[model samples]
Target: MNILVLCTGNSARSILLESILNRFGEGRVTAWSAGSKPAGQVHPQSLRLLQAKGFDTSAARSKSWDEFEGPQAPVMDAVITVCGSAASEPCPIWPGAPVRAHWGVEDPAAADEADWDVAFETAYAQLKRRADAFLALDFETLDADKLRDRMNLIGQD
Candidate 1:
């Protein structure tokens, strides 16, 4: 299954979801993340948190949602919004009419902190909780009705 994880900035929540899904999706899923209005750089605290958790952050970067709208775009099985803006913004018609859902998370980049590590840790923990629920889903065994029900439960923790 190909999954597209989206956010407004593609810097924190979306990036973390992509990494966790890729790591735990067991090769049955490939994940990508993008933004409505990208920050143009991955958030530093996100990178640090992922690194501390032993995920490779070297390839992480902010990208636009339009990258997935072209005819040549990868057909997504699911397109999940992990932030407030992408959840509320008018989204482009996804290539495959993929299962769409919102998994809104607090933006760690927006948190005011003298030590940013705490903010990143909070973000990381939230992403991990949601992603764990998502990865636990048995997509291959579900029929359409069951799948819809399961996807509806995607980010609930």
Candidate 2:
């Protein structure tokens, strides 16, 4: 399955969840992250935490959602929004009619620099639990409606 994670900035929660899904999906899924209004760069603390967790940060860039719209874009099976603003804003109409879910997390990037470590860690842990719940489902077998319902439930975890 192909999953797209969205956020207002694409620098923190969305980036983290994209990495988590790809790492934990174990070849079952491909994930990408984008923002409605990108910061144009990944957050430094996000990169630090991911690198500490042994993730390859070479291809991790904050990008616009426009990159995934229209022809030639990868057809997403799911589009997840990881912040309240991104979840509530209008999203691009993806080619594949991906199931949409809101997995809102407090933006660690909003925290003071000194508090970034704990803030990002808290967001990461919450998102990891939600991602794990989604990964635990037999999603490939379920129909889109069933998959969406389950995904929404996972978002609340």
Candidate 3:
């Protein structure tokens, strides 16, 4: 599945979830992340945590959600919003009418610098749990409606 994860800053939660899904989803999924208002760089702690966890950091970036728009863009199967601000704002209608879900996470970037390690780890754990649940489904066999339902249920996790 092609998944797009979104957040307000795209520096922490969305980036974490995108990395988690892509890493653990194996060949079953391709995931990218963007923000409604990007912070222009990946949060340092986010990169640090991903590195400590042995995930590739080469392709990680904080980008605008607009990058997903247009005829040449990849058609997404799902779009997940990972922070309350992003979830509450109006999102552009992505191509392919992708199934949407809100799996809100507290923004780790908001924490004090000293607490970033713990904050980022906590957010990562929640996102990983939800992504794992979603990837566990026999998604290829499920119809769009069923997939959407499962995604919503997984978001609640």
Instruction: Tally clashing residue pairs in candidate 3.
Output: 0
Is candidate 2 or 3 superior in lDDT?
2
Off by over 4 Å in 2: 85-96
**Structural similarity to truth (TM-score) of each candidate:** 0.86, 0.92, 0.91
Off by over 4 Å in 1: 85-96
Query: Candidate 3, residue 73: CA error in Å?
Result: 0.6
Candidate 3 lDDT tens digits, 1-157: 9999988888999899999998899899999999888999999999999999999999999999889988888888888888754335544334455588878777888889999999999999999899889888999899888888898888787
Q: What's the lDDT of the predicted structure labeled candidate 2?
A: 0.88
**What is the alpha-carbon RMSD of candidate 1 to the true structure?**
2.7
Top-TM-score candidate index: 2
What would the per-residue lDDT of candidate 1 be over residues 44-119, giving only the tens digit for each residue?
A: 8888888988998889999998888868988887888776442254433344544777677777787776657787
* Global lDDT scores for all candidate models: 0.79, 0.88, 0.86
Each candidate: RMSD:
2.7, 2.3, 2.2
